[model samples]
Target: MELLGLDSFNLVVRHGGFGAASRACGQPKATLSRRVRDLEESLGVRLIERGGRSLRLTDEGAVLHAQTASPVEAINDALNDIRAGLGRPSGRLRISAPILFANTALGVLAAKFIEAYPDVILEISTEDRFVDLAADDLDVVIRANPRPDDTLVGRCFMRNELVLVAPPGLSRPARVEGSAERLTFPAVMRMGTGDDDVWTIIDADDGLPRRYHPKAVLRLSSPLTIRNAVLAGAGAALVPRTVVAEDLASGQLISWGTASGPEIEVWVLHASRRLVSPKVTAFVNFVCDHFNAPTR
Candidate 1:
């Protein structure tokens, strides 16, 4: 089949309909429809099922789409890279990151990046769930975990540690020597459904590990929310230090300094198969430099 026909078909499938694809590609809807029909006729198979108010791909169409999508994307990326190499980086870069990180330092960093690379369009998605980068057509995904995924090639820019913190001026019982005295304050937990209701911490004096189950006063799924609750004197919570570094610095919250939780590893992941575009490489390097600097 011709490359033009295949490109039109890909656009239609990606945008879900001819009307949307036409608007996106700056082509007439009739022209796009004709291209796809010509492609199907040349292939001798029904690619799409047309009906009232909706479009569905046939079995053959799905197979062809799955086979061609990656190659087409790679070709497009390569062409874009060539054009960008000739001049300044000028293309759309789509990224996905967690909501907490997006709301924190990532936003500032993104703004700085945009200011530095005025020609590139930066699109960011702040969602808690993991997004399939290739399937979703995203260029990069920033995530926090203990290790990078073996499937993707990326860089770990920072190490995030969870800390136990409380609102400033909250009274607490003093630690007794050689005693595992449990604190009686209510706990604010950042937990999802089916998560265990316990926290592990190490004794600062003895360096021994122990698990403490505080009375659950507020349970939330977002670290930012838990930090805000802790700042409001709701209860002590275990949260990533990045989420509350300013609060801890300003004495809005008090760090318990209990190094019991695991450190969260932050990574920027890209697809392993596609060639790393100039825009993607620039972003990865900028973020790494920003976080890895000595002052940070």
Candidate 2:
């Protein structure tokens, strides 16, 4: 339990500054700073150094961090093992997911998981930004681009692919004679979500990079708006395969490419905790299995 405070300290150190750490932790900047200071007071050592906006671990703090990290993680793992032996998991499991994945994959998987573990109450949060598992108490997070931190364990569960899609009847813009290889079309950019619509494609014929940078006609944060714009034939768009799977299957959307598509990876990450807990472990296992299923 004492390691929990140490874990929080670890986050601030890793993120480099309190503002960034607070954003990751989903806590007010002042509150996170206070908590860190309180933890340092209890430890009787100054663990972090403040240089205006910059942060660095003290010499003693770095040594203590390195020493305690692995053992704290192992202790948590051991506790989780003890809980799982009791059988059915019963507790609250909080999960965060990307907007596209949440709209597409989570629906069926979540339903089945909840049904199998009735005692587990699921709290799901759909956000485009990276979720803070430690402060938010999120059991797991489904992130598009997985970034592992010192205080978190990440597991890649499923594979995804990015495909350029447009409305079924939408006509490809007429390519200029010399610019046929490179075309410019109006596109809806993903704004404020830490992503852009730059399409990345690889040619299987040759291991060459064929990048497509569509001219963004509009920038938006809503995936639904992007989909609607694509459907309306406003312009071409690159969306995740999972999000537009049914559309692709039903011919409502067409995948535009001469070669293969971009590689997409799905990862589930969890913060280092005192224990994984039965509910979190069960839920993680369920998501891993369900997404990797042959039919899914």
Candidate 3:
């Protein structure tokens, strides 16, 4: 049934007559009467007993008034709430992020976001894959080195580089004979990595690039697991500096060298087809501010 007609019928019932309802709401009496008639026709029930002495309700009208009165009021309240909070961030916002980013920064970022936007209910999921935002019903996503997508838009919030790190006791390898400082070391590597996988590191002092091969002693999938292995003296591995900043500072892990020309670009993204919601906008601003990074 038409909500306007139902509301008009309720108004007429609550006020005792069409004229009274019109006077109370400043609507034309003809409009209220016509809407009530439309409501009755739509419901296939005569609601009001017309041509009565004052205003009388048919049996069906009485039941409709009893059943729909409170529900209509509730619907109106919910609509009003949406209107009132339109300028504010108030809703459920589902987000997807890479696993390593979530493990490193998402917890603290989520805490601050919820504190600032108490109205928004935030749900975050951590996975390493680039998810389909619309298909997954996600409001936002965070990724690293996100492939070019014309359908996605957002800001780059963090830029970091990969570095070779090892336990404090593990010494750097000597340069290979008859080579331009090429070396090999027992290294923890990602699963599926080739045995002869080579890494290039920029020399900190000489500002020259050097090639090194990781003799894979341990192969793990998760970056966090690899970092832990390096800390436990399993072997050296190339990892993101931010992920192991504390370990390097406290002398638990030593940096062998910085990975050559690798920039880890972290981005926050959302679907570009629809209008951005207030909650998503608020979150984007919050993350950019935290990292002091510019929007892409």
Candidate 4:
């Protein structure tokens, strides 16, 4: 298989169609189609099925793409390394991030990052779902409380414990720890990992852990939505303090206490590779420095 054809095929898959790939790379649409067709003919296997409304990758196509995407990237990185020689970060940097974080905070961070490194072209795709670094062709992914994965490596940039918050007009519930007649407050909550609806938190005043039952009146999908519900006096919600910090300071929201669960840790990670790209290192260090983390 010709390397040019392989590159064209990957580009088409990456951009979702030949036309889009042409538009993205400023290549002739017919040339890309011919290259991809040549690539399939050379490999003796059909990669993209174009008989539908849009192009969909066949099983073989997916496997080939996943197998080749990183190696091709490594080749590009090698060339970039030789030319740039640890100079200013350059090239397209693709990233995946969580939805709420992207909407709330990422815009500002992207602006600052771009201002600092003008040569690098930043592309961000926001989704709450986990994505593959190689399969998705992404340089980095930002996640909250990600499980241990040997394939990934990075540093936690933000660590804030969950806190229960209510509207400013709501009165604090009477603390009745371990009491049979404990108060169950009306709360806007997401589905808990456990079966029971309860808030185990550290009392801000006493600095001791407390348990409070929460009756979920409305179930929300994301913390951002829960915060909105809490703001509308829908009910109390367990959210990160950083999420509601500004509201608390403005006296628009009141924190009941910090939850006694794992801290809400946000991390920026990339796939573990032999030679880390300068752009990747630059972005990671930029994030670490912004978050006051000395190192990963």
Superior by TM-score: candidate 2 or candidate 3: 3
Best to worst by lDDT, what's the order?
4, 3, 1, 2
TM-scores for the candidates: 0.86, 0.62, 0.71, 0.85
lDDT of 4 by residue, 1-296 (tens): 57788788888888889889999989999999999899899889999998877879999999999888776766677577668765568889999999988988889989999999988899999998879888778889999999899989999998888888999787777866466544578888885534376667887788977778887788888889999999999989888787899999999998778978678889999988635788889999988887797563
Highest TM-score: give the candidate number. 1
Better of 1 and 2 by TM-score: 1
* Pairs in steric clash, model 3: none
Model 4 per-residue lDDT at 156: 92
* Cα lDDT of model 3 by residue, 1-296, tens digit: 57989888888887889999999889999999899898888889899999986889999988887777645644553564478575577767889998888988999999999999888889899898758875455778999999999988999889999988989789788666677765888999999899878899876456667788889999999999999999888999998889899998998988777987759999889878666767778899999999998645
Write the number of the candidate with greater TM-score, choosing between 2 and 4: 4
**Model 2 ranges with Cα > 4 A deviation:** 1-85, 173-180, 192-213, 258-262, 293-296
Model 1 accuracy (lDDT, Cα): 0.79
On the 0 to 100 scale, the lDDT of residue 140 in model 4 is 92
| List of clashing residue pairs for candidate 2 | none
For each candidate, C-alpha RMSD in Å?
Answer: 3.1, 9.1, 13.0, 3.0
lDDT of 4 at 57: 95
